[model samples]
Target: MRKADRPLVLDVVGDRVTVEHGADVDVTATGRAALVAQYSRGNVMSRSLLELVRQLDDGGYRCVVVSTCESPEPLVWPGELPAATVVLRRPNLGYDFGSWAVALDRYPAVAALPRVILTNDSMAGPFAPIAPLLEAFDTGHTDVWSLTDSYQLGRHIQSFFVGFRDGVLAEPPFRTFFRKVRVEKEKMDVVHRYEVGLTRTCFGGGYSMSTQFRSNDLGVGAENPTLAGWQQLLAVGFPFVKRTLINDPSTAPGAENAAQVVRRRFGVELSDWL
Candidate 1:
């Protein structure tokens, strides 16, 4: 069968997570966020992640960045990172989860911070100030929240940007999950281990979950995130735009694409990183 048409199967053989057809991710735990992000490349000309870190810092949120790449090399920052930001670069063992583990193992100070955010350089913006967004979530009113929740793979909060308050942040189970996670190399591994795994753990542990963008709640259907969906996300104070639509555009095409429309209609440049 063609690789794409083949089903992915993972079997746990003792300590090794073997896959049917996949590559290995060497998640090296060299170090360890109030707002931790996993950077994919060594040198890139994008200011989106840095911008988010700055915005979060300005809002008085402690921020740490775990810089990494698929290969073990020196990760580069385009500009001077704030002193409050603690950064470590290593091999991309487990994608975001590997980065998360690096942060937890290296920095014990953030191990039990009252609140924390796990995010990555997946999008572009803070098109507007994020203080209001943070204000709403940081008020300690919700146990947890994210910019959005997805029904893909399963009903799980998209891992790009998830915030945790003391309820789950201070719990033993939360840290344990992070500790035991494998350096998963498969896409399904990420979905099952981190995305769905984290959400279920938090919810099952009695922590409430919330999001900034909801289609039904906002009177919008998932017709096309570019149609009015992007605007809706922006209007709700979301700080970034997914790079897939604008920067690479795996889904949209030509002028009809969401990135081009966002630029023409809203004047929001989604390729600030490019």
Candidate 2:
């Protein structure tokens, strides 16, 4: 079948999803909120996932929801979703990266899918930057396009370095991984230092021109450190997009500015999209 004519099947698994073709398959079943709540505590982007699914549904993409949790719940949304969407809850069989690799090996169809868009949450709004990612799939620029957060630098540094040095990151079933790194205060000086010396060596080399706005959510602040790690990664050379504002009660106007900046930079209307 022609590429554009092919069905767009999105699998929303915990932390990631695998897509496949076939108009008969379901996408909503793979994006259940309960399954996501299993991996996260408190308010772990669950609302975001719900919103994302809604946007994708409006955009005319087929979705499927899957549960990788042990005692999976009947994944459901508070409001109505597109009728065309499908939902499925599978028995949670412990499947980490290693196990997932084995499963893909066994199910070649999963690995052989034409396009896949994997995200940790369903509420990622205005995913325009990812347009290139979808294009990459069509052009065969990569086998896997893993969607990542913009504020995670320490994680990216560790993952990328480990993968580059030990070749452990060179496993099968994934070729290109897209990570979004953001900028913040604690790491700004370090990033500037790198920009002066070894900028080209880092991912998305040099600091991002955009600034970040964070909310004063006690939970988010408690969980994520400053963006120093992200700055470091940028200095080293990884391509990333900034997630300007974090939705926290502590920061009110910051969120508004962040939304505006993101909209200006990416031409994505955060209010309209989110």
Candidate 3:
């Protein structure tokens, strides 16, 4: 088979991308290549996804299926795709980010035989104008790529900072605890006192560390039974209170920027495969 005619499979993870070959039994082995894009319903951006489908079709890709978190029925724009291209749908596993991790881990088995071109849903726009889909196939760098330039990177950073600040202010222990204590109204003093007791027990006793709250009501506040139960587990002999604040920027810009700075200081561009 000609190189241009080889199959291509795309594994999309919201704004992240990973690529692999399709399996022998899959559509790619039948000579018609496939480009699969995973869509999460929780994601607010769909325009880029739609554009990617259109671009792939225009570039003569065989299949353009959008796996969305909606129903089994995929949203297909027939006119936007070529006759050879087919759109199919599979059920999305709700709005869980972990679902994408599960999907990417399994993608190698699902589309292992065909030539793969992995890209993020966000890359669809930059790709739409420059045939980025074709570039993925041409350069053989389909694992992951950044579509936006440095300016957009700065904007994204600013937005993240603002959101983080707002989130910190709105956090339960910080906002709710302080607000109730400051408000001197005696209409429901007992309830407020009870809340203060629980808060004190959790934080003051060092039981709230590394604990996550689970709530029965989707909209209501969470309850950390483990923290509540931990109060009883503390040994009387080891009465030293050790409080640690877990703030990890490693998952975000701290590690990323550090790596970037190292590369820049060394006057090198980090290899993508690393």
Candidate 4:
């Protein structure tokens, strides 16, 4: 990692860093990969998170998890992650985007994979097999695939769950984008600069994109579909629900029914994820 690329921690935690090395799986041989960014205040892995990784691995993705926690020590593993899953621990600093930037830098091999999925703990479930759909989408018509697209800020692939195909990661602009990613103090600033900026970069580089749920089909105006249109998304067999919708029901209208609705629809108890 370059000195400049190293994350600049602004907190009083000093420069404490922990890098738990894992057996690096050659992504080139794996054919499919996932970079999952995670953050836990107590350094404990949640069941929902464990399920996410397991599902990805079951779908043939070599997963690399970059976790950020208050403590410098590694995250508490649930003993469920595949043996090949690489876990890296870092001080909570630049949010998910920051953690992802660190992972990309640490494992350049992920960039070479023919298909790669970038996701985070901000959402819940693969309640269904999504890898086949992603593989289907990677046939070259789309350079990027996302579970859902949003229009709150602009038309961009929602960063929480997205896939990159056909060497989009190898593009010079794509690499430069991650290289230039910095720690943004405000949450919205990170969303604007990185989340939204990512799709814009792809567009500039002439990369095509697709989404499972279209914003127009879900919601309108500047509302987030995963929040405002979650029920509709779920009704359409969308396998995941955003954490914001469940963590604080008041954050989104009708989210108060998440537990009941999810249990009835997907037959998976929401309390399990909570």
Candidate 5:
């Protein structure tokens, strides 16, 4: 495998966490929010992630960026970070699931808030305005929602961009699921047990769930809709192209042209990430 395709192995120690407050982070800001779980080896924040953060900020959500990285190095905030947002640095353990679990535990009060978006830096672009999507999530009747759904290994909302409203957030099953989340070394284990598992937990708890982009609606067949039908997704204003498509286009046979397609059509440059 090429270097970029290698699985990341961080210096993980069991559940050890440390916190840092950005110079101007709204330490007092609390309420309806978005928990953006991020992992960056070079400590550089991507422009796409930054754009997504700005959109959430504009949408009136408190942004809590959780960077799951090697421990002990102080997190240096890029001046580009919004002043209102805060940063939480922890040891990389359970991927995005672990980061979200830690962030959710840190801010217990967020559960009571009307809406909470659990997202991460797994994809690129907000090439389009996210206002419409956020509006649908807020007003939609579903207890849990996501940008898209996939039927890959069993139906589940793609974990990269899931939303939790009041009902699901308050459910015991929701809290219990996170409380029981363990650090898994294998990425697919994290997916099956946490990513897909969260969706199962929500349904088992009797919570209504929906997605802005349904798997069937895409009319595409693949384990991952984002990777298989990326062009179709973008054509529908999906707002993001899976980052893996750029990192290793061969992961999806026809997606090798994604970098150029995104640049030419959406005017979003993903070449830097490649």
Candidate 6:
């Protein structure tokens, strides 16, 4: 297929473009892809994010990356994206959720695929090969899955990364919920309505949800975990460590950045995955 180029569709301004990687997506593939929503200050893309894209591409996923530029400069995507991945660039309006909604509405492949992953740049992960995790999730019985779940927000599946089975994707409630997503400028509002809301809606609609790391291992509320606790999350087959556990730019304060702490003590930088 040809390299993705700017197209005149959905909101466009200047050189900003929306593109999907492949012309024909293999909907029957056992391994699924991640619809990544990434944000940047300007034209340049994040190296870590690029590495993540490459890993997803190599891992047999037809990644549909949604790049949202949060700067005055027009989105000039830097570097070469894999031919197997689709990318869309737009103004950062509704944070990650908005980008996800736009990509789902515009890309038919996203809905047609049997297994779909709605994830973002918030985590630095797959320090080791992700093949094992992918194999675990390909079971075909999961209605919804997440690397990790959070109880702090009323037992809702954290929105940073969630898997949608074919049943959920092809249904009306899922489409209606995502399309109706309001663009909330406030981070908390988005968190409440989307991050927490999506999980609840899916469960309420007769869908099941689960997480890799059992919160019981982390204690009730599953909020503050020690360094060993973080390691155990990965030890239990959870892929992609949440960046906030280390240092979150959000107002929430944490003990330490797990990446930095793990590196200082274990000499292994999980974010170094490439």
Candidate number of the best lDDT = 5
Per-residue CA lDDT of model 6 for 1-274, tens digit only, reads 1113322223333245555345465423534668899876666665557767777677677787787766655444446777777667776667788778777776655665667888888766555566665655567477888766666657777777678876467588787777766656578877887888888788778887777665666653545232235655655655555565555434223335555645654466655531
Model 1 lDDT at residue 142: 75
lDDT score of model 5? 0.78
* Span of 10 residues, lowest total lDDT, candidate 4: 8-17
Tens digit of lDDT per residue, candidate 4, span 1-274?
Answer: 4536544433222344445645565545677888888876776777778888887787788888878766665567665568778787776778887777777776787786888888898877656666565655566468888878888887788899888886678679888888777666678978888899999998899888888788888755578988888888888878878888788888888998888888888788887774
Best by TM-score: 4
User: TM-score per candidate, in order?
Assistant: 0.76, 0.37, 0.31, 0.89, 0.88, 0.78
**146-259: candidate 2 lDDT, tens digit per residue:** 222223323221110011111112333132211111121233432322221122233333222211222122123322322323233222222232333344423333343555
**Per-model CA lDDT versus the true structure:** 0.60, 0.31, 0.30, 0.77, 0.78, 0.65
User: In terms of lDDT, which candidate is stronger, 1 or 6?
Assistant: 6
Runs in model 4 deviating more than 4 A are 1-17
Off by over 4 Å in 2: 1-47, 54-62, 67-73, 83-86, 90-108, 127-133, 144-274
Alpha-carbon RMSD, each predicted model: 7.9, 14.3, 23.0, 3.7, 5.1, 7.0
Q: List candidate 6 segments past 4 Å from native.
A: 1-17, 20-31, 72-80, 220-231, 235-239, 245-260, 264-274
Model 1 over residues 65-127: C-alpha lDDT tens digits? 665544454445567655566555554456777666656655555655556777877776656
Ranking by lDDT: 5, 4, 6, 1, 2, 3
How far out, in Å, is residue 218 in model 5? 1.4
Model 5 stretches with alpha carbons more than 4 Å out: 1-15, 23-30, 71-79, 272-274
Tell me model 2's lDDT, rounded to 2 decimals: 0.31
- Which residue pairs collide, candidate 5? none
lDDT, candidate 5, 110-198, per-residue tens: 76678889898888878888999999998998889999989888999999998888746756898888767776768898888888898
